[model samples]
Target: MPRALLRPVWRTLPRRALVAAAAAGLLLAAVPRMQSGPPDPQLGLFALRAAALAFGLGLAFLLDDPARHLTTAVPVRRPVRIGLRVALVLPWAVLCWTTALLLVPAPARPPAGDLTLEAAATAVLALTAAALMTRRTLITEPGVMTSTWLLCTAAAAYLLLPHDRTLLVTPDDPRWQTTHTHWALLLAAATAVGLRACTDPVRARLRPRLSS
Candidate 1:
């Protein structure tokens, strides 16, 4: 069943959106390299963060299936299908992110480890929100809405979050460690919620039990 799903699932993925987003991310990451003079460290951080946001926006569409209603009756479970899609795209996303990182000049680069954590957290948050919308609503394509919410939430956090609990602190700031600690927590929470949202519905769960 898993092997059979590979072809159809691959065909259904939002390839154009993902590809475009990846290109945008790589382009943004390369912005620092394109500078005429010494690359500014602040610009490096902004570029990387922007790249990460672009990647997350693409991921916001990961679970969208135009034929979602048709596929609801498939013997395969919801989580299985969702997991398969994620598994297929995960490697490509990672490669794109890595390339984005590499595009930044070393002298201008921010701490790679910290920036990677921020990117991971951002991506997972997008995925979690997408999954939740798919699970709870009738909308087959929530990418636009999800991406909008992600951006709005990011902007709000940036503007409203208190200094001690901020997530966008600079490498030299005292809050750097505290910020990443929050990021780690956010990643864990988002992962948990996303997994839950991808689960089979209540009726589906009871069907096998009732049959047996």
Candidate 2:
């Protein structure tokens, strides 16, 4: 496939699709349980987090114009550009993943604290990955700053909802186990995607242009 189309096809679209799939899967998984009665707070939280993940990934894809470098005539430096790009994407990624971490229900049974140190480590890794990808993409196309801000705002609103709080640091409810597992999986996927996006060879060739 042409390099022009490769980014959207491989990186942007696929990531967006993956986010959608994850969200759908979570909702579907929770459906059967909902038939029993009102939706469990834990399950609701999982669904919301999954949706937020999808939105976050989508924002990254939208802000990144994979084809821009191909069209621009200016000769931009690669390293500086890449650094700025990383800086831009990082905040959104961190916001999304951290919010997700805060929103995911924790297990009741733990060795000591409410959340294990291992879990915190995992969360940090996930947040870092998400931030890297998002920053890189946004920095590549600063024109989308307004959109990025909107996304950030929306994510924050979702995270701050009353029900969302119940998901975080809630009592030891059995329903939370499933939600916790899904959160871990989501975090892992975000981390993997972030790493791949940052290391893509195409970025080296794109070069960075200084903001006006």
Candidate 3:
């Protein structure tokens, strides 16, 4: 029965759309590199950021359900339905990130574990944001809303946040472990919030979209 329910849900998923967007980021990372010149870690770091940002942006669209109203009447629970979509996307996410890592030059690339953790946290944060917005505002078009907020938050974090040893890990940053610890905490908090967003509400709540 669950498998049967997923058929329609999977059909509506924007798998190709997300993959295409992520592929563009991978291209930015892989292409435009000087094959003959010396490896510049900064450029590699930029590529990594590009790929990570693109992946996170793609993830922001994961919770979007234009037909959500139609599904509200369906017998399946909302959390279950949302979980199915996430399950379907996990393999694709793995493939996309793996491809992105393989495309980068080994020498120029930051430590794979650290970069991967950052990517995971970013993706989770995107998911968390979408889930939060959906529960709070009940937007059918959460993608556009989440994407905008995510970019602004990211930009602010990078530009406005004061530089300290306890910041996000950069290419040559000495506080790699400390930064990743913060990332770990972030991942945990986001995951917890996302779960709460999926909980069954006391009332049948479907708030209007942000624009409304």
Candidate 4:
């Protein structure tokens, strides 16, 4: 049953769409660099990569619904189908992250040490998003999942990157003070809203009974 569902979901969106969108985002992000400004080119590239991840994830969620499309021909179990969908989506997320890391310029200063905190935070955020995608109930609310994922990723990026006192300029700076305070607040607010929608006890109680 799950296999049956998996086949169509995988085939629903063309690979071209994913690649095109990712590329377009990257190009747009590079615009800042093209102009003669002192913008953090690395940060702009990271933003592009983040956008790609969001786009790919959004496509996966949009196409994963069994109700909108037929699943009778598929031969996989529900759990298996969910697993397969997650497996498929995982690569896209990884690709986005890798692209962002690669495009962004390396730190100007010598490495202070391993970005352990940032790495751990990223791992946590990725796992959380993947878990949400695997759960049938969670995937239904794409907005919540997207918001949660973005918030977590942003937080992780802030914590993981090296901090130079000079580099800490704008709210967009990927350092401790600016990122930890401004971006954290934005992401936290988003996470709170997403969590409220997903885990609201009153809504959860009513949702299952109503659906039944």
Best by lDDT: 1
Candidate 4: C-alpha lDDT: 0.45
Of models 1 and 4, which has the larger lDDT?
1
Q: Name the candidate that leads on TM-score.
A: 1
Q: On residues 1-212, what C-alpha lDDT tens digit does candidate 2 reach at each position?
A: 23343333334322453355345434533442444554465554444434444444344343354555552333443333333444444464455444444443333123222233323333334334444544465444432353354356446645775663433433366645654565466566756754555443454455432332
For candidate 4, the TM-score is 0.43
Tell me the lDDT of candidate 2: 0.43
Task: State the lDDT of candidate 1 residue by residue for 39-141, as single tens digits.
Answer: 8999999999999999999999888899998888798999999999999999999999999999999988999999999999999999999999988888899
Off by over 4 Å in 3: 31-36, 205-212
Query: Judged by TM-score relative to the true structure, which candidate is superior, 1 or 2?
Result: 1
lDDT of residue 128 for candidate 1: 93
TM-score of each: 0.95, 0.31, 0.90, 0.43
Better of 1 and 3 by TM-score: 1
Query: What does the lDDT read for residue 71 in candidate 4?
Result: 41
Residues 1-212 of candidate 3: C-alpha lDDT, one tens digit per residue: 56888889888887765877688778877852655687777777778777888888888999888888788777677789889989999998888888888787888777888788888988989888988887777688698778788889888888888888334547667777888888888889889988888865546544433335
The residue ranges of model 2 lying beyond 4 angstroms of the native Cα positions read: 1-39, 70-83, 96-212
Tens-digit lDDT track for model 4 on 1-212? Answer: 44455566687533654566557545644444455646564555445434544454344333235352234224343335444655676676467545544444443111212222232233334434543553435343343464456556555655765656232233344564554444344445544443433232455346657998
